[model samples]
Target: MSTHPQSQRRLHAKGFYDEFPRKGGTASRATHYCAGCGHGLLHKLIAEAMHDFGLQDRAILISPVGCAVFGYYYFDCGNVQAAHGRAPAVGAALARCLPEAVVLSYQGDGDLGSIGLNQTLQAANRGERMAVFFVNNAVYGMTGGQMAPTTLAGQKTVTTPNGRDVETTGHPLHLCELINTLPAPVYIERCLLTTPANIQKARRAVRKAMEIQRDRRGYAFVEFLSPCPTNLHLSPLDAAKFVDEEMAREFPPGCLRDRTAEVAARPAPPPLEPLTPADIEAVLDKCVAVPAPPGLDPDFGTIRIKMAGFGGQGVLSYGMMVAGAGLADGRHVSWFPSYGPEQRGGTANCSAVISGSAIGSPVLSHLQVLVAFNQPALDRFARDVEADGLILYDSCLAEKPTTTTARALGVPASRLAIEAGLPKAANTAMLAALACSGACRVASERFSDMLAQTFAGKPALIAANRRVFAAATEWCQANLRPE
Candidate 1:
């Protein structure tokens, strides 16, 4: 054997996976980051600290949308991927939910400083029990080397071809200084990773941040002045020199705030309780009985309904009523709503599933009952109804549907509601038609109970809705066939 010890021959963090093959198939040992990038070094340091502290099992590494988005493939511990600039919020939630877990939020300059500035500030301001590692590479490395919020003044980037201009683009953001200004953060430090001495200091800072988190101390932020050689158009050695000579002058790596000694450990969170039927009943008010109507096909116990209309037409509420009726009748039910950008005068729709058995999917492409409140709504969703299904439309539509596969029924729902002195109850009139026409198996008493529960606060409108429901039921009974 060679004279060199096993440790001397090779070194790797126990907390890190054996290989980073996903980063590149060519080199199983190497990472995907560009040569001279600081992310690899930072990752090794953080992983080593976690391993040395015996926190590998209890650690949760949160990687957001950035150069390190694929960190889950490297770290052996519990990993959570987050949306761009959402790592801090995810880390805060994990820390709160699992008090014993050591949470780590790793993010780059663009993600933490720009789009996620508010989330970062809020998490720090609350003194969340976690550690945040901010890598300042002065450019968006992963997404085509764009100019980031922390890009140095006079620095040249793809967006800033000539150079970063202070007059047009603001100055480089100093995260340590900004976070230090806050009262909640316990420890805050800025360190460079270019030189050997600086690397030792950065390693110690990383350990200290993790140690603080282990003790349940409040927020600790460590800013690393990292390099992005590929984006900066510099060689690996030149990138280190640039960070040491030029970038360090602007950032000034040092401790901005240290309150670790003065702070106490946070209190442990309470244990979660198991959900009980009594708890469900207390929250849901009550559970009634479901009796299938006579006209429904006994072969299929599930009813998929879709309601589409203008935003002000109460399409969402109409679906909710069906779902609520199912819930009250002790059936499995789900309701989902979708709408356009504009709240009113815009198209809106919702899907609901009311079944005696378990609900597999909340979304339905083929609806058994479709209620369309407008011509556009009818045109958009009429084709999706099953061939043997029912299509109910408001009589106010200027153009009627041309679907020959499904049974089409046009009712004066809005006109009847206005006649009953409640123009806004058009949705209830359609629901009444659904109930009386035997399209839905729900009883009128259950619908009345749901309306009572829905308009409990607005008791005056409940009576008008009952009258509208009665009129629609009578009209459906007189004109519409049960089958």
Candidate 2:
């Protein structure tokens, strides 16, 4: 090796990998960004700061969905790639969980200023300890040249071919100005990346934000007005000139808020003590008020059930009861509910999964069982049942459902509930019908215990619901085949 002076030899930042293996190929030494994208420059500044502050091991960089999503390929520190516009939220989680670590949220204009605006503002408002690097290129760089929230008026993009219409699309969002209005942020600055002097200023701003993170100071936001040559249909030199002349006119670069000197460093959170199995059990028992039972047999397999009806029809309650029974039987269970805005008359549905083993997902596509309380529910979800699945509908409906794949049975659930003097217990009647059909492998004793636990406060209605359930069971046993 040539013995060159330390200052004369150029070296890569310590925070970055020696070679980007994720890029793969002979060009692994190069970045994936276009010729004049500002992401490369910003990445260099961040990596250098991480190296200088000795924060490489403690840094957790959150990369948002955009051109910079490949940040994990270069940054050697902890990296988390968030969904489109969710970097700030993910950063908040990391900041809370790993309070000792420095969290950085790197986002583009389209990702942060548009879809992630709420998460960004909320994190800043809550004074989350994280550095937010907002690269404002004024256009969506990843998914073609779309008009971003920060796109200036009259700026031409693929979505706005004839220049942006102020009347239809509104003016560009001034993110720095908006963030400055919030009180929790410790430091906020907007820097331009154009001329040599401006680039140096931006470098300082990036370092200052990292310093706040190093000190564990509250929210720090640094916005960079960067160039996007390919998207702007301009040469690299022209793009730099465009950012210096035109973009700077709209978004003047300067320190908007600086409380770093006034704010005290946040005290590190106390170390968390590990909890033993007995401690965890005690906590769960206290919180859930239920004792853990032995798990069901492996032969039980997995059962997917869906219940649907009007909002006030206790559809969600039916799913919960099924899930609770599964829990009491010592089986893995999941309940997912979906409903419309209107609480009473609107439609509602819920999916419940019971399995002898661990459950992968709660959402069911083709269900083993579908319980429909109304004609609309039957019409909507009847065809979703599997070939050997079972469909139980309220016999009170005026129309009969047509299905060739599954066995459809109509039970007088509403009439049975009314006869039992509990009109709202139709869902309980349907549950009883399901139990009698043997589609679910839960013990009958567990179902009874679940009912008692569900209605422990209402002593009067328990007997009535049990009557309704027994009537539904008898009707199903006599009329329907237990296929």
Candidate 3:
């Protein structure tokens, strides 16, 4: 008689990926976590909970910039790898956007307690609908064995050579205690994974947190007091003992807050309603009719403009005026500004795109019209203009560009603004010159209208800007040709 084969009892979660492969096409069944590390155990617990709750399909896991960064490779559910300490913020946003989806933020002690402390705190205080799993290993494990915020007072790390200095670094932050003070979070608990019994308790906490998310409840946090054997310079057994004894003495493993009984499940958000073409047209029709220049090429699909100057020279404002004019003309527009470190002395630039059709990208590599408000601005952006493009430079700048294949026009913007008794209206003068020279597709009258709208709050300056604009337009008409 043939013997019946015994079935294997599967312990691994079906939510985990079949295998984690290296970039070079090699598949490895083993994880990168060190032996006796708590990450593998924690990952298993969370994955199993997700599998049991049937949340794998609706789950979105946000992994922080630490050892858990490779969570995207293992978790079969949706994964978003966030910047250091920003997992909570990202998870909160994902939860809000996908109200029905279960969002999980997985972070290490350094990522959550150090640089990302503010983000984590704010998310918990807001009672965002999500689950946060914090693994407190008391050391920065990914970059190096550097001192983490949760590093024990006498613990030795790369930064804390002899031991942690409480006077200078302060005591290890009790995250659950701090977060518990907030009124928003529905559940806040701390658990350990050192012993088998502790592991069972931790697994239950993980499942409970996931269950709250499945029920569409408010914020829930579970911190795992885990072991770092390699960094702690101890064997697996010794590390487990350290977590159970010394670490637990500082960070007692138990529930700090549990309001699940009092809290009600949040209602499911309304489904998104699609808009028809007529609805979109009704919205677009509200734009003011700013006429284009006469005899402008109807085939002109898009125009790319780049404006650059010193930060205080209103470089961003000039680009905004151009974009505003395009919008007033019922055209699609985008304005992107780039500023250096200091807002005042730093270099500032902006790219404005006006398109008859949908604007695909705000970034511009080559410019159709380049406006430079100073010598530095001219020198920096002259090479980026197209061969047949137009370059409008301030006449006060002595440095003339010679490398560009574009046609260059010099405008006395500063002198003209001063002549109009408004030294700050230099950018307005350049806008007028751009219209008068016919380098831009928009009509000169449309630019004047935008100037009126821009300075509407300061009615006294509107008259001075219009005068400066007229003067610059006259100068451009006489001196420059319409290409």
Report residue 57 deviation for candidate 2 (angstroms): 1.1
Model 3 vs. true fold: TM:
0.56
Report lDDT per candidate: 0.85, 0.86, 0.86
TM-score rank order: 2, 1, 3
Query: Which residue runs does candidate 2 get wrong by more than 4 Å?
Result: 1-11, 274-483
Question: Per-residue lDDT for 1-483 in model 3, tens only?
Answer: 223333111434567886765221342545667788898899989888898889999999998887777888788899998988998888878887777789999999999999999999999999999999999999998766899999999899999999999999999999999999899998899999889899999999999899899998889999999988878888988998999998999999899888898998778797556689999999999988876544333466789999999877888989999999888777778999987522124578999998876776899998999999998788778999999998998887535679988988888899999998899889999999888866667776888998888888999888989999998888888888777
| Model 1 bad stretches (over 4 Å) | 1-11, 23-26, 274-483
TM per prediction? 0.57, 0.58, 0.56
Q: Tens digit of lDDT per residue, candidate 1, span 52-132?
A: 899999899998677887788889898999999998889988987787799999999989999899999999999888899
Off by over 4 Å in 3: 1-11, 23-27, 273-483
Please, what are the lDDT tens digits per residue for candidate 2 over residues 371-472?
999987887888889988888888885256776478888888998888878888988888888888777788766765667777889998788788888887
Rate residue 435 of model 1 by lDDT: 77
